[model samples]
Target: MSTDFHGFSSGPDSAGGAPRTVVDWITVAGDQLIATIKQLVADGNVRRVILRDSSGREFLSVPLTASAVVGGITVLAAPVLAAIGVIAAMVAEVTLEVERTDVDGVNESEDGTPPPSSPDPEV
Candidate 1:
């Protein structure tokens, strides 16, 4: 089955930026859970990945930091991924409520689009 996606917005964060919290919701089949999560993590922008069942009960929340990615993921994610595999087998469907931030620390507008560039100096 095809997946669905939508964005949820929040205000400025500790980074002192506008719309730093952009959450995207993706619903995927239980069998596709691990693959989807791996893809998202590899993108290197995701701040956290929360998996929930059809009934909206959160099963696991994987918080991924930049360091975790740069430091080698296999060491940190192997166990967690194994657990996710088990969960995927037991559930028929799951919804991924994932948070993606600007990997470069760029700020985004309320609509989840990048902020407009500032005017050049000494025009």
Candidate 2:
């Protein structure tokens, strides 16, 4: 489905949330996660925030309060982080290639030169 508020869209519903499945959890989690980060940034007492995956996998640990030795660093850093992420994703898409080459039994010229045994071989 599509999120109208932020214009974000997710992939197909595979987690079986039907009308109220994992998507709801994801949406709620996203909202809560942003709010929690903002809160931690605003509190100025928070030293850091450790985030983990749903399967208990440690994903990231960020030092927001001590990043800049000043208050409100996280608040200022959030947009920069987001922009970096977007730029990184775009670069990845531009640099990464996954096409399959047909190398089974194909033989072609390598340096714009035909084979020596060809009938029309150049002198």
Candidate 3:
């Protein structure tokens, strides 16, 4: 079985001078996890996929690029499935961190201004 999850966070990297957002979703089923990762790669906007255990500790990080997909999506699946299998044996929830391309902060706001910034104490 599979469950739905949505997590929002940002990274320090700039995309074309704009900031990029790392969107995360957590799931338990290894197969479903693989499928989700595959789709993310197919979409092309994904920068990378971070695999994490239930404790939120990342174990595997897959960097996706246009060249990597040149062979076909199947090539990417092998490593992700193997990693997921290893992680599933040890943890229940696995987190998939999908890094999206930089978005215009002003576009996210109703007004033509950047969003207010708050210090993330945890960072």
Each model's lDDT: 0.69, 0.32, 0.58
Please give the TM-score that candidate 1 achieves against the real structure: 0.73
The 10-residue segment of model 3 with minimum total lDDT is 114-123
TM-scores for every candidate against the unseen true structure: 0.73, 0.36, 0.59
Regions more than 4 Å wrong, model 1: 12-19, 103-123
Residue 34's lDDT within candidate 3 is 54
RMSD to true structure for each model, in Å: 9.3, 23.4, 8.6
How many angstroms is residue 111 displaced in model 1 relative to the true structure, after the best TM-score fit?
9.6
Local accuracy of candidate 1 as per-residue lDDT tens digits, 1-123: 767666665655636644366677777877888777766766666789899888889999988887866654563467898889999999988888888774335434556542333111112
lDDT per residue for candidate 3 within 42-76, as digits (tens), equals: 65556777887666788888887767666446667
Candidate with more favorable, higher TM-score: 2 or 3: 3
| Clashes, model 2 | 1
